[model samples]
Target: MSSESTVLIFGGCGFVGFHLVRHFVKTSTFTSVAVVSRSAANHDNHVDGATYHSGDLTDHDSIEQLLLKIKPTIIIHAASPSPVTGTPNEYEHVTIQGTKNLLKIAKRSKDVRALIYISSSALAKGPEHVNLDENHPLANTDPKSSAYARTKALADLMVLEANNPFPFSEPSVKETSWEGHLLTASLRFPIVYGTHDPTTIPGCLSALQKGQIAFQLGSGKNLWDFCSIENVCAAHSLLVQALLNPKRSPGAAKVDGEAFNIHDGSPHLFWEFARTVWKFAGHRPKNDKVTSLPAWFVLALASFLEWGYWIVTLRTKRPYNLGRQQVEYACFTHTYSIAKAKERLEFTPKQDFEGGLKEAVTWSLKQDHWDEKLKHVTLTN
Candidate 1:
């Protein structure tokens, strides 16, 4: 709230966390900003004003010591393994147990005021979640969901349930007279894309370079939600402001122990968005360049590939990317409602779909993978 407040971001060296560090350093009034990562030695994109601490969330003693040393007023939990590539053990250790450790430490830490978690829309289950909201049932109960999703859902529940005004009955510290409770909340982001995105946009560029972007999954009629990196950073700032502001009314009540979906506020057809990005990246799509296939056929192929990869990697630990989840993401129509985020956190998307795509494409053009043959192509018209 004030310049005295210290904000600490876990997983600060990561894609989203890097943007968050820059946002806090450039925009936030908080005096002290620190990022915790497993190893901060060679972090390439370090911000000027923020501090980086080498720590591991799985190491409970290290985290406890770091929290005691820094005494941060706000803790932003953004550290987690990649949803597509991480193993079950990594998810359990870093996402579930690590979050539990943080909750345990924050409950007794007097200076800590708020704990903001970065969650995913994958927590919602079933095809019926076309317009998912906070009340949607979590996928943690579903056995068929990915290990990452289930563990993250469990962590989300822990953070929300730990949001008590009174400290836990069994305090971590007995002699301390400080008795402040921690406020907690979470923001669910959908397919975040921006300059430094290591996932969606890069994967698209790879497909385009390999000439594999010609086929559309199903009819490409599915509308999906995407969150711009800038918008995600803005939502975090707005929620933190609401959580720390005492003068703010009961409207802020919706934020405590609550989860809000943040997106670009515009859902776009899957193929249309893909073609737009391709066009912006200097690849012009022709009528024959793009084709559609039945969703069932593609899903079947994905299942086969998954089975083959699992059998081949019986002894190794390699991960397969093309699977049922990828098929579902390509063909499913799941858009989140950002009305709660807007009303509660006063959050509005700063960049629309085209603008965000333009930024991402501009960045992509400068990368080494940009095709020289279509260098003159533009998103205009």
Candidate 2:
């Protein structure tokens, strides 16, 4: 980054966003770093050395003013509703319209030379996704998909399209800082987990504490990619470096107006992830056994349970533990190729899988003050 380089992150207090804040703060590469969060005062997980601001993404007036005041050289948008618990309206405001506002304002915030979006590769297009890459068509408007997925798919496309400095007028041949175009890119991830993680690792450990580890959702052959937090953060840093050195040729073109899948370059059986978490939690296999349940049968059982629960509990915010989406994730192969990330951003996993898991489990349990005995953990809402 140049002497005027300043990085501003939209969701700086979030799981992924905070990790990025820590990454930049620890590395101290940029001249200044700032983060905008919806609620800045409530973050117990916030990192040091980075300034924090409270602001809503939908409020265009405040966001535009903040951009002008900060004059950031690099901007990373990692803000969005929770994928598991978010509603359709939440997706609309934050993922879709919020992204539109960011792009619209970014066009005028000329100091912003680079924009990186943290996106998810967990789009449910079919029963399985094997080695899918940036070329895979997005199902942003699929009526069958969840609102979170639909809107996220749409926002990622928006980020790529906004790469041009002139969206309304004629396009320029090449978009660079000289041309005043925002060099935009998106990094797609699946199942990110590590230290200070509130979801992935904890969910697995919660299942273990509830004595549900041996229950298989479907055939245990399904596979999914998992990336450590350090790996994901490393990819973001590499992209920042690449975007700053865009004149590096063939590799440089890969940074702008592109989306890249990022992961550990290895895929494991779905339940294998949970089993590994249990191993780190001072547990030994009593037996190599699991109770298998057919996926179709589970889905049928879930549909009936969902209707009855709605009638009984009337829980409008439905988060059925055994819903169709959960079943598919546990029974399908959802793996992606990180070849583009490697070739374009020169990205690779900074932490080894099992080693990283050990570090995560150790840090997470310490936070809970567990005394070598597994304690009860709430797995869901």
TM-score each candidate: 0.90, 0.89
TM-score of 1: 0.90
Q: Which candidate wins on lDDT?
A: 1
- Tell me the tens digit of each residue's lDDT in model 1 across 1-381: 545778999999898999999999998658889999986768775889999999988888989899998888889999999877776778888999999988888878877878999999888876435888888888788887767778888999999998865343544322233335778999998788888777777777666666677678887889888888989888998898887765554433567888999998988886666677787786654455567889889888987887677678762332445766777788889798988988878787875788888788777667534556344434222
Tens digits of lDDT, candidate 2, 133-250 = 8888776646766566678889999999888533323333224343357878998999888887777777777677777876898899988898888888889888888777634454
**What lDDT does candidate 1 reach at residue 247?**
58
lDDT of each: 0.80, 0.79
Collision pairs in model 1 = none
Which ranges of candidate 1 are over 4 A from the true structure?
Answer: 166-180, 248-252, 315-320, 367-381
Worst 10 residues of 1 by lDDT: 170-179
